[model samples]
Target: MNHRQSGSMDSVTIAFELMRLELGAEVDNLNAYGASLFHESQYEEATKLGERGKALRGFLEKVQLLEAEWVNSFAGTAEVDYQDPAVEAATRQILSNSKSPKTALLVRYPCGEVVAEKKGADTLIEVIKRAGAERVAKLGILVNSENIVSRTPSKKYNEARVPPHFIKTHSSTAQKKRNIEQISDALGLGLTVEIIS
Candidate 1:
């Protein structure tokens, strides 16, 4: 869908959540309220509410279909498999087994400040700039507030540190891949999604 449709969907999603929280499973109350309005001679408002109920039901069906599609997308993940000799060797070394194995993300980051390279520097340079910004935010080195890295250190701000529990929780290869991609994108880290076995 286009950006406008996507934004409108997001608004509808929020509205759906809010309505769920307030009304719970009593969604039939909307129709009841519309009936009450009709009895009170407010035909226009009742018609509007009835039309809105229909629209809400339609949106819910669309959301359910999207959810089903997303779930089905993970059914065949063999497409992510890469059968390179180097990757196989690495996988064998990591797992110590050639029969069954799992894939892990290998991230490579610059030791210190990232300096621009002369050739093919566009993407790397942009990543470097983002990495610098991320580091600054993490350290709070140039901040005007009291939550600096020196005192009241928070794990949330540490871009370089990936929580072990997060990796453990996201056990699926696809989930791990997405998580690593998000981390790599957020921190501008170089990553190799060594799709093994």
Candidate 2:
């Protein structure tokens, strides 16, 4: 796995590559459509297609730059591996139930207690607060991809008078790191994405 703290292309880099391929195809399609419309003498529709093609071309260029930037940002990242049978079990369980992928935060407090929970709104802070962490020295955060189960509850009950529920859709990993970094910085803690095989 390329989870080491070295500057190398990772999954995000690969995803950007795939995105570029798709965008390139879209741009080609738009150009072909525009040319066809022009041949049919529909000047107004042809102009619209041409403009859309231009916009897609511009966006494709931006994606390339962004991909380069993303690849360059992975210098000396401090990635730690989280090793705990219980935690691993919990993570697997959460992932099995989750409809969408989730990020888990493993928080180690000053009192030598480690808490593993899903990353969400102020989850780290809330854990610290709930743990009653005072006179803090430092905090360590481990981030890893996990599964988050989002259940859709029914307002009305079934024939058995039981409210039924099901899973639904949700939302990314690199962007997740950025968001986690903001919160970790705000809380004055060290953060690292955990390496999982």
Query: Which of the numbered candidates is closest to the native, going by highest lDDT?
Result: 2
Off by over 4 Å in 2: 1-9, 75-197
In terms of lDDT, model 2 sits at 0.43
lDDT of model 2, residue 149: 15
Model 1's alpha-carbon lDDT is: 0.39
Candidate with the greatest TM-score versus the true structure: 2
TM-score of 2: 0.35
Cα lDDT, all candidates: 0.39, 0.43
- Which lDDT tens digits does candidate 1 get at residues 1-197? 45455444434443443333223122234555666688899999989998986776566546545544543453222232333456435533433221222222233455544322322112222432444434523533221122221323433222222221111221223223344455466556665432222
Model 1 misplaced stretches (Cα beyond 4 Å): 1-27, 75-197
Residue 171 CA error for candidate 1 (Å)?
31
| True-vs-predicted CA distance for residue 188, candidate 1, Å | 62
